[model samples]
Target: MTDLVLGPLLRHVGEHTAAIWVETADPAEVTVTAGEHQASARTFRVHGHHYALITLDGLEKGTKTPYQVESDGELVWPLEPSIYPDSVIATFDHEKPLRMAFGSCRTSVSHDSAGNKLHGVDSLRAYALRMSGVTDTDHEGDPDPGPGMRWPDFVLFLGDQVYADETSTEMQTFIEARRDVREPPWAELKDYAEYAQLYKVAWSDPVNRWLLSTVPSAMIFDDHDIRDDWNTSLAWKQEMEATTWWHGRIVSGLASYWVYQHLGNLAPEEREQDDIWQRINSHDGADEFDATDLLDEFADRADQEPESYRWSFTHDLGSQARLVVIDSRAARVLDTENRSMLDDSEMAWLDEQLRGDVDHLLIGTSLPFLLTPGLHYVEAFTEALAEGAWGQRWTDIGERMRQGIDLEHWAAFQDGFHKVSDMVLEVARGERGRAPETVTFLSGDVHHSYVSEARSPRKAARRRPRQQSRIIQAVCSPIRNQLPTGERIGARLAAYWIAGPIGRLMVKSAKVPTAPLRWKLLRGPWFDNNLATLEVLPHGLRMWWASGKVEDGVHHRPRLITVADVTIDKPTKETR
Candidate 1:
């Protein structure tokens, strides 16, 4: 019997359909059964590894059913009388409240006391223990689930699910044993095999594995998923392109990402639209579809021409909300003369998706749109300087500094930033139909977490009776990783003091136009390893951050602790 290598990860749960993704040691027929209904798919081969994404249809809306996975007609998941709870597939309900858990920058590490001490506790693992009905006898501070509160409807893994650039100790050991550690690219991943191994390490923890099986999840990638400061600018790209191993690394990264992360993000219809999916579906031979060459060509083309493919996706949650997960990394236009966070087609797509009429409008980007006012201005300042705002003499130095300091964000691309901000403002003001209750930008990339709000001072002075939607920036990060003490303190000070005044002055000196809206930090710069949950309520939006805390001298079993809670009002004429 071949053991499963990766997942039974539940993905893309719609009203009547769900997709489960899995990886196995060899080519096998994978099946998913929920009650009397079942769906099966043949594993597709990529670089000799096997994967399948099984889509189950004809499900009742809002129904939660226990499910099992079988490979080669043998029950491989949910072993008989399992200690963990049954894995479930929960369909969407239009009338039900929407709640989603989100965070970024999780590392794959051990779950013992020493591992916890080094990397901080894993919040997702703690939540898994709670969901599985494990008694927290060792943890005194674990929050009891309130009456009738179930697990979040789904989870939005914002970005950096795996750290490809920053290899773990174990990964480094494996690389050194297999090849020369002194080679180009060093300890970083070089090909598909390494990436597959990295993912196995990340998802193999028992508690987290079970959590993934039961909960529907959606994900997008950030810089670390490829490399640190990936595509920061034309110069960075050129430098990487010159390396002997970078081409292989990037091609492998994108190809593996498509199979592991991006495929499950699509509905069956969407999958049918994908070229790779079509190739897999069209294959008729008994053996799996070996897609190594096809995937390599596709990845190379995508890298050479960023506009050739679209990685962004949109999901409407049955009139309650619209989720637009933007591809901030792969779709970048890094030409220094025409630097844009997104290419023209990607920008147009985002513009169309950021509309109104829903209760919530969610814009999920890996990078924060509303950075601390100070940091926002600093990034803008660097962008202007990079563009020779001060003088041509400093242009090259400014560009170097920009890439070195990792200052490329939404604010850095002023044109793109202004365009999206204008669209957001219009949506908030009901220019594109009924304004949503909130226009929230959900982001993670920076290791810190915070909440901020944007307001147009002109609207406040006019005293308009029409209800204007609130504009919010909600950030959650580092589900496992924690910043070093010195870096943390420096970041806090910069956000609080230096970035604000100095950054603003720099922008003014550069003669850049003022932003359409003013924003300020509302909640935090917490450095804890946390995951946040946002719930759409009848009145407004409620969000809280949770962290894993060691209790009663049992560090292995960390308890979930609430870090902060925030409520945004759903503005109405009566309330105004």
Candidate 2:
């Protein structure tokens, strides 16, 4: 039997359809069975590895059905008499409230005492233990299971699902065995084989694997998935492009990402529209379409052109919320003369999706749209300085500082930031359709969790009698990786005091136009490794941050600890 290698991951579950993704040991016909509905697809080869994405249709809407995967007609998943709960596909229901879990920056490591001591506890694993009813005690500080007793509609993994640059000891061992450790790119992933192995390490943990199987998930890539500060600026890109192995690294990174992460993010219709998918679907059944060449070419072209293909996707969550997950990292325009977080086409696409009508509008970017006011201003200031705001002599130093300190947020891309901010303001004013109850940006990659509220004096001046939608930014980060103590302290001070005033002064002195909105931190700069859940309510939006806490010195198995709870109140008629 060709045993399942990577996943039985439930992806893109709709009202009457569900997509199940899996990888096998070899080429085989993979069958997924949910209740009486069954679908099968042949595994397609890519770099000698086989993968299949099975789409199940004609299912009842708003129903939950336990699903099982079979390789070559032999049952391989939900291994007979499983100790964990059977993985189920839960379709979306408009009548029910929508809830989602989101976070970023996780590293895969052994979930033992050593890993906990080194990386703090793994919040996602702790959550999985809770969901499986394996954890017994709440423990004094443990978080209460919030709103829904049922599973969330889906989980949004904003970015850094796998760390290609910062490999663990285990990954390093694998690399050393295959390639010369002294070579360029060193321990970083060099090609598709390494990336495939990296993914197996990230997903093979039994508890985490179970969680993925049950929870329908969507994902986007951030810097670490390719390399640190990937596409941060033209300088960084040029430096890497000159390297011998950088080409292979990037091609493999994007190609593996397409197979492991991006493919599952697309729905049936969306997949049909994909150029690569069309090639895969057109195969005449005589031989498998080895996507290695096509993917390599596509990745090369995408890296060179930025607008060849779109990686962003949107999900309409049953009239309750609309999720627009943007590709902030891959689709960046890094030309020094035209520095932008997104290209014009991407920005326009985002604007088109930034409409009202849904109860809650969520824009999921790997990087937070709104940082703490202080940090946001600092980024804006740095961008101006980098662009010769200070003087010709300071330009080089400023550019170095921008890349070194990672001042590459949305704020750093001033033009793009302002354009999107205007779109958000218009959407809030009901210029699109009915104003959403909340326009919230769901993000991660800052390595800290926080909530910030945008207060626009300009918007307030033009405000009508109609209630304006609540504009907020919610961030959850480091589901596994913990920030260093010194960096944590620095982040706290920079966000709270040092950065805002000084950065604002610099921007004003540079003669840059004032921002349309002003924002301030409402909740945190918490450094704990965390996962956040957001629930859309009729009146407003409720979000909670949870972390893994080792209780009573049991370092191996941590309990879920509540970090913070926030509520964004909908504007009432009286308040308006």
Note the clash tally of each candidate. Answer: 0, 0
lDDT of 2 by residue, 457-495 (tens): 645646643437878899999899998898899877877
**TM values, all candidates:** 0.96, 0.96
Clashes of 1: 0
Candidate 2, residue 551: lDDT: 76
Task: Give the poorly placed runs of model 1, Cα more than 4 Å off.
Answer: 137-149, 457-467, 572-576
Candidate 2 is scored at a TM of 0.96
lDDT of 1 by residue, 1-576 (tens): 556898899989998999999999999999899998899889898998999899999999999999989998998998666678889999999789888899899998788887887788998888777677663432222233632247888899888898888998888987888889798788999889999999999998887989999899999999989998888878789989999999998999999989999988888899999988899888889888899999999999998998998889987796889899999888988876888899999999888888898989998999999888878888888888878888899788888878888898888888888888888878888888888989999998888999988877665426633438888999998899988888899989887788888887888888877887788888998999988889888899988888888888777567777888888878766432
Cα RMSD of predicted structure 1 = 2.2
**For candidate 2, which ten residues in a row score worst on lDDT?**
139-148
Show the colliding residue pairs in model 2.
none
Worst 10 residues of 1 by lDDT: 135-144
